[model samples]
Target: MHSSSSSGSRLSLNSLTFSLPLKALALTVALIPFHTINASKAYQYDAVVNNNKLTVVGVENPSTVFKDGQYLHGFGYDLARNYADSMNVELVFTTVPDDATALKLVDQGKANFAITTTSIQNIESKKLTSFSATCGDLYSLQKNGLNTQLSWVFKHADDPLTQTASGFVCQGKQSGSISQLASFYNRNVVQAESWDSIERDLTKRMPIYKASFQRTAEKYDLDWHFLAAIGYQESYLKPDSISPTGVRGIMMLTNSTAKAMGVSNRTDPAQSIQGGAKYYDLMLSKFEEVPYPDRNWYALVAYNMGPGAVDQIQKRISAQGKDPNNWVNLYSYLDGNKAQNGRYRQAVQYVTRIRSYLEYIKNTPQLVNI
Candidate 1:
């Protein structure tokens, strides 16, 4: 009887051990499929309201609505972020060779959006899976004094609007025309010292000074004009302007930025503008994820007080639970004798002037292209 009891006890212990293993094995089996499903579902849509992971495809140039490095400073960036934020998802940008590639990427489902200053047309509308909305402004650059038609591609074939619009043409040769237009539209225009003299100065300035600015602008994918705007704000386009803190030249470059830009003469007009433009371009590149309208403000602040300070302001605003993109909301937090000082206020004013200038130039009968 004792032997029988011992055998039964041993059998009960074996059952307990086997039962535990069986339970564990069942749990593992259940988890394996769950992991697979999660893995297979790599891309999810509408994950959050204002944080969608969207891939924007655009060109490689600085003027493009979606520049290579400055994805957040143009109309494309603003529209994408606005849409994503409304949906609550993070935006992801994908740079493309051209508009064709952008379209192709979207059609293939490789990108969630294509925002390279696209015009809605019947052909593209049918081909692309997109929503109907004007995301940014379309600009035309024409030779000064030439009347040209501005073209628009409509979504509907029978849309009752002309494909081309007419506007006044500005004589590029007019004194202060470029500057005036720039101030009006908040966009920058290159004013050659003189068409007659540019050929002479071009050779002199090209390699040493202009090339550097061009290279930096290309590197950061920023409009040379945007940099010029910073220069205008900083030093009023005077390469010889000096600040109390010893900031010099058109860009009001300090000794440090000038040196970093490889400028040997901080007072030279060419070197000053070049260095300043490059520096502003760098600042423009930092807010690549912000929308274009808001990006300009951030760029202006960064241009005035350095990007680090602008970042601090953004953090402060965010901490206070306000939208950093909203200039109205950001202005209150940016004011006071705190971190950014009146530099923030000055930056906002400068940017506002630039924007107004851009609009004015666009509307100006003398400057508008027909």
Candidate 2:
């Protein structure tokens, strides 16, 4: 196993940044791939939503909906889009600062469901709206493979970073029972900084690294955004970075992983990127039937948790009525892998965040077409 065995430290979705200014420009689009029932749709859509012009109130939550001013994503966006399409409506999306505001909009009938973890508890107090099926969840891994029992005391339904409930704060190697505890007890835990610090440090370096990403991605016929996103996620595009588990360089390759891919220096940016790309392609080859986008998403999960882990999840997905090759459906199935203890969730976030960043890169003026 790679040195980064501890799931908490390695699969830290809490570390993903959600800092982006909300712009007045509501693009009215659906970015994710869901079918549209109509062909006579209107015109001039930015994101990629339904046709009925449905409006939704939300917050800048990348965990559920990634709002980057130009585009809105995640379950909320997809839900609204699908609902609108089902009803033949167009999609309109908005973001606020907190969950109370979002839920209030829904409670008052100003928009659709609040569609957030925060909204879950607050809705009970309001009578104008009803909470539907578990719209979404804030998944946090106590540890990798401790025990996939989702039985933690899911207190603090809104705050997940401090994920503590009934004095059960999860720690390494002793957390396999967390999910079981949380589930039996019937609860779910809920859960950035930087200034120019991240921007200033990464500004100049992004171009050089993105160029590397482009080259490596093309060499393998892979999506440049994906290869780059993995590099960015693995080491924040830092060629010299090292992970706690001894993963090194921009791609965060473990020593054995690196050597197996013919990489002599895991710290070298080009060597690491290319090697990581090769490894990723190898993983992608495992699922030949999955369509694009979803296929890429599955491959990314394989890159993180191993193909065996992905295979197990896909098997469960197939067992369910959902399509195992479809990422969006498969993603929901991952949550059902109660035995994996949120490792699947880690992969889900890993892919979601990377795709969002890829979208961000495409929208960025300086970084476009790199």
Candidate 3:
């Protein structure tokens, strides 16, 4: 069945709902060098249509919207092109050095529109026309930099560096990619630390692991946010993290899974994130019959409790004529088993924390579905 959304509350697609609220705990601050920029001084968020014929956008990640040998590809690129086609306007792609420059271009009428992931605070200050949409596939990994984590950054397409993976989404709105992304996560994460602690120490290793997470998550056919949530749940992203049970490194994989994923050293951030993503990918494959989001939960539970344990539950659910694919149904079975309930709670909290953080980055404070 196709679904639509109300304009006041949503854009063009069905809303994504992950009901989890995690308390942002008391964090211990640590400083990490962040490559940050502000668009407040550079451009306004309002749509400045100096010429109806031209729609100029500022771009940071050109791979997202770029032309390759007469073929156009990228989420943002396609979005801009499609929108322009709908409006019967000419779309011009321009190179922008920074947010300030992009905003300045839009403000000075050098460009009709500037597209970048500029913070929301700056956008409001400038009162620029925002499409009121952002790409859910894009991730905002700010260090423990509160008041600095970042908000309201829109994506631009046509960067030569972005992967043209023959990806096709629901064909509308910023959430298209994000909705697809939601299919890759689950609620079976082990919550080892408070949100506050993760917040405080995030900056320390975020710079180190963020790129690796993105790279590995992409390779494993998962969203970076899913792996990131797991990383946070496992060790708060501490590269040197070692659990009491001896699960090692950022993604906290046991030595067996790590070695199987081609990780020689679990303590290595790159190895850990990549290995963990691969392991989770395998878990996802184990439950292909499950639906999205719920499928993600199944994958997560399997990741936490191992495929063997989850397989037993699935068989029992099937034997009882219950749906083995629905997370809620599967959870009902788990809830009845006292031995597994403890892990179920941890998984819920795990997914909740990650989803909450991802939701914040996906939308601005004004539009966040909290």
Candidate 4:
């Protein structure tokens, strides 16, 4: 985690930075099949060419791959989903018990690739398996003399799909889509100087409204921690907090928005939290065409910029012949337009800051069950 002073902590879309914990890196001592296969040989598989389905296997890891109800979501899942989208194929995800099982399924041709938590050095030195581009945020585990990186594994060194996957990874990284995805998924949470105050609030203030956040979040099928992040961002969890713009309550809802959400009293904590969750769910439902995780991000952007503004940006994206459903595409265009577009920069920073707070909330578990 990188800490920046509150005065200087506004991260731009292109240069978001965070570090993986060394202890977390030490836990991923996984193995892959060792072989001396020639890398120059051209290889193609019938399943990949004809099936029109991208089968991916991965273990349940919060940062890599995990289940949210019926949906698979994480950094690796989104990465693989992007690759599948590029191929215009259906993504079929299978959750295995561990990295070894995921790799075995790939080797047996049951899965095209495995989202494995290992190092580039490990793959290069001993593993016959081909790997996709690094997912960024590389950390050196000096004790083991290995560089920890998250990558997808394939069965062969020269598979044609491997090259395709690498290309997609490279493009995603270059466009800042991958890092944005990482941020949205809480893969790397950057702790700023405000973190200390947030920690204090989590203990002193959050517990006071935890039940309301949890209650409304469950009602709307949303994460309470996420709702709490919005409250903290908006009004620092003070129900009576009022903005100069007249938006009030912990969620800082406008008068029109409060009325639309059926919020009678914006100063009431329960009503405010409920209204925020329902409004967020409404925003989320508007972007159902977008994939999970990205869908969540688009909804967050919508929450900050209004659904109509987001729609306009999506239209602009489509007009440019880009994938509007992909937030990275949205982010890339916004990044280029930031100098001339205040709304673009606001939406980018809004979602990024919320995700960071959400990550901080998730990491602080003691406040839960209070």
Best by TM-score: 4
Question: What lDDT would each prediction earn against the true structure?
Answer: 0.44, 0.51, 0.50, 0.66
* Candidate that scores best on lDDT: 4
Write the residue-wise lDDT of candidate 4 on 299-320 in tens digits.
7788888999889989999999
Task: Write down the TM-score of every candidate.
Answer: 0.40, 0.50, 0.46, 0.71
Q: Give a tens-digit lDDT track for model 2, residues 1-370.
A: 0011101111112111111112201111222222542334222121122333555555654334554333444433443443333334455666667767766665454554444545323555554333221111223222221112212111123221111111122221133222322221111111124424534544667778777877988888766765766777778888899867798989998899899999999988889999999999888688777644346566778889888987877787778764567654555555555357778667656765576555455455665543
Off by over 4 Å in 2: 1-196, 336-342
Q: How many clashes in candidate 4? A: 0
Q: After superposing candidate 1, which stretches have Cα over 4 Å from the reference? A: 1-220, 285-293, 322-329, 335-341, 360-370
Superior candidate under TM-score, 1 versus 3 = 3
| lDDT of candidate 4 at residue 261, scale 0 to 100 | 97
* Candidate 3: C-alpha lDDT: 0.50
State the RMSD for candidate 3. 16.9
Q: State the displacement of the C-alpha of residue 120, model 3, in Å, after optimal TM-score superposition.
A: 31
| Candidate 1 residue-wise lDDT, 1-370, digit = tens | 0000101110011000001123433343344334334343323232222243545555533232323112223323333443343333455645566676666655565654454545546326545433322211113223321112212222222111111000001211122222222222222333433333433433333334444454655665555444534554566455677989998886787898889988899888767766766676576579776554445566666777788877887788789886665543454455443365567566546665544333333333432221
User: What is the Cα-based TM-score of model 4?
Assistant: 0.71
Choose 2 or 3, whichever is better by lDDT: 2
Worst 10 residues of 3 by lDDT: 24-33
